[model samples]
Target: MTDMASAHLSHDPKWTRAHSIFSAPSEGADVALIGIPAHEVSLSATSAHQTPGAIRDALARYSTYSSAHDVDLRDFSLCDLGDVDSPDHESGEKKVATAVANVRANHKLLIALGGDNSITYSVAAGMWPDLSKIGLITLDAHHDLRDGVSNGSPVWRLIQAGLSGKNIVQIGISDFANSREYSQRAKDAGIHVVTRDVLRKRPMADVMAEALDIAGAGGREIYVDLDVDVCDRAVVPACPASVPGGISADELRQAAFLAGADARVRAIDITEIDATLDTPDQRTVRLAALLVLEGACGVASRKN
Candidate 1:
């Protein structure tokens, strides 16, 4: 009989581990992962800078295969470029931009792991210096149009930086999560918003298609901001602004996959999760890991 200790060491050929897929950058890769730990300027208190490592750890809990997409991420080359040092300050943002610029041309897709929602501004700026050439899609509970420099102001800052309001599409904006003033700000910017109620009524596929159409209009590359707070509070306790009536975990995963599958989607960021604030089970970080896999699945689908 096989001893218990020996059995624990046995490898299963059918089940490839997820974490094994990512390695140090070599040549160009199919996907590039970068950590932007930007919690210093978060509006709500957050330890989000610790999230990128937490998400990487959680990837060990998953596998490289996705039954939903009928693809294995192992088929693609993935690399982790490590974290941007001190990305929460002005100089750090400059580093974020430089890092993104340096790597964007080398990978098929770039996935930026957030320190906070604030990373959205730096990452997007890094992806496209001329913001007018790229469209924006944000999945979040807030309008993120608040004034000043913080997690809540990335969208507004991007618009001010030259991203056209008409080219932006925000999904899952929740009721009571944002103020009337910010709602007006979103409107005045001409940003298309698909509220949480609309998500409940429309199929995710349809919503995603519409978002991509608008944001990717005029052949613009797209950048997706997947703020976990758009999910139900129960689904993402680590997300400071999550509400009870937000979208489900599955819905957010679907959106991530859909965004990744599109060729126009050049970059994506997962944000607003304070790993230190997660539940005992670490469900939030686990979900964030799955979101990364889902996006990778979408990238794999593009080859088909």
Candidate 2:
């Protein structure tokens, strides 16, 4: 606490290097998590651009290295590869594709904390090598399953990357502002849309059973895209498409836990955190940290 607040102390690259998520790193960990704040996005309501650094700073302050899993992520080589400069939309996608692809090759799990949903498209480009057997799980209020032009749609990129039609499942979709045409297109394109209504009805465990049946039935690799809009309006207000009713943070935590528990979830990304909008989200930062931590924990749990 003393070191974190001092000016010279506040910006020490070594402390930043040791604990911050932005240190340039070599690849060799049980799981590789990448935090790329995509807030420089071209859309409205995507305040995600500012989230990466904030989350990293919070983790450095609030969390610590643990060896409980017999693998300390801190002692292990998990480096924050720094933010890809996606000041431009198309170029941002390109950067994400390249950074993620490079990490995907060496690391068992690839996770990206994004600036917007656009990061998803790029991550899919980087990770969708085995299109014949990839499973996508998106926890969002809107079904981002678009036909290459769904507004900020990442699922289109996965399909473009060659992920099969039957391998994508969208959880937590709300009908508030989602397009029916787009919904039908998503369904026709082989994306299973699990409604918010259904999730509300059953226990998260049951939802996992269904998601596993839909996505992991055939030993498919998993990609998780978490849009903060899936959270209720107040909890994560940086996203532009937030609706009246949505999943609670507890629901999201459980969903992430469930996703991590799946054996074939090869890579993960948490997106749509607009930092500029979330002026006072110490909790959001904490949530993102836990999201990444739990993600790693999930992979560790699987290995154990």
Candidate 3:
């Protein structure tokens, strides 16, 4: 076993450690995982660059088997492509695009561990430079349409880069987290908005299906961004923008799994977590790791 595998050894052979399943880069992988630690231009102060590694490390705490889905991630071919060095600037985003473009062809799904929400632009850009052919779904607490190159502005940047706003859906948008200006921008751009209040009344599965249908309209490929800040602050202390009334952790997990289960959903990125800020119980990072597994389980369900 490799060092990572050894550290996560399980007592029972039937119960495999989750971290042990992802191996070195290989061909025909079902899932390809990569780290994009881009925190330089964040709107708020964050040590989010440490999140990818923390999520990876947190995987050691869980088993590959998912009781809910009756699936084992070990049965899938997973690879870790490591991290993109210094992905906090334009040149680095290009590196992210190039790296994603290189491996996306060989994998069924690419799960990009984010430094922040900024990776959404680069990853989606890499997946489909012709943004018109792809749709976007963001599970976030903010509009992410702020005017700048920071983590809060990727959606706007992507829209500027040719992505049609009509095909974009932003869910879990909190009341105080965004400005009326950006809300109007989203409205003007034809971006669909599903507020946090609405989610409180609707089932997560229903919301996910609707978002996927809207974003994946015209049979376009979809990219889902799982920004951790969409969860309640109590659930994700590491997410600076998370609020008291945001979605529950379970809802977020369900959303991720549903996104992964859809055939048209080509890629997903988990973002906005600052590992260093997590509570003593490490709940935030653990939840992020579980989101990865839930997504993998969703992918595994495709064979059923």
**Which order, best to worst by TM-score?**
3, 1, 2
Q: Give the TM-score of candidate 2.
A: 0.83
CA lDDT of each prediction against the hidden true structure: 0.90, 0.67, 0.90
Best-to-worst order by lDDT is 1, 3, 2
RMSD of candidate 3 to the truth, in angstroms, is: 1.9
The clash number for model 2 is 9
- Tens-place lDDT per residue, model 3, 3-122, is 663564557777677888998987798888899998988988889999999889888889998888888887889999889999878899889888888665788888999899999998
User: What's each prediction's TM-score?
Assistant: 0.95, 0.83, 0.96
> How close is each model in CA RMSD to the real structure?
3.6, 4.2, 1.9
Tell me the lDDT of model 2 at 204. 70
Residue pairs in clash, model 2: 38-115, 39-49, 39-115, 45-240, 47-273, 47-274, 47-275, 48-273, 48-274
Worst 10 residues of 3 by lDDT: 1-10
Backbone collision count in every prediction? 1, 9, 0
Mind giving the per-residue lDDT tens digits that candidate 1 earns over 1-304? 1243134443678877687799897558989998998999988788999999889877877889988778988988899988999997789989998888866678878899988999999999877889999999999999999899999999999999999999999999999889999999999999999999999899888999999999999999999999999999999999988999999999999999999999999899999999999998999999999999999889999954
Tell me the spans in candidate 1 whose CA falls farther than 4 Å from its real position. Answer: 1-13
**Highest-lDDT candidate:** 1
Q: Ten-residue segment with the worst summed lDDT in candidate 2? A: 1-10
